[model samples]
Target: MSSSAAPILLLALAGFLIGGAYSTWKTLRWLSISLGACAVLAAAGAILWLR
Candidate 1:
């Protein structure tokens, strides 16, 4: 490949990786929230059952 094309290709790859990482981060954040909500509900149910 030509030198000029290499730089542009590398930059594009970097941008694509950054975008993928950001989306993964967002997905994890939502996943954690869902897990936390489930945990809280489970605890509440257990407390009520014990009472």
Candidate 2:
């Protein structure tokens, strides 16, 4: 794998996690929040990885 691939995958994972959070918000508040937090961390990791 290339150096850039990891960050790119991280971003994609963040996107999926955000979507999962949104979809689960109505029925699973706690899970949604957890997924949102994870998404944020993934996004932050991606940004830091690029640096």
Using lDDT as the measure, the top candidate is 2
Per residue, candidate 2 scores C-alpha lDDT tens digits across 1-51 of: 799899999999999999999999999999999999999999999999999
lDDT of 1 by residue, 1-51 (tens): 875555455545555544554565656876555555554555455455445
Model 1 clash number:
0
Please provide TM-scores, in order, for all candidate models, with all chains considered together.
0.49, 0.96
Runs off by more than 4 Å, candidate 2: none
List all candidate RMSDs to the true structure: 20.7, 0.5
Note the residue pairs that clash in candidate 2.
none
Compute the lDDT for candidate 1: 0.54
Candidate 2 minimal-lDDT segment of 10 residues: 1-10
Best by TM-score: 2
Residue 7 lDDT, candidate 1, scale 0-100: 48
lDDT of each: 0.54, 0.99
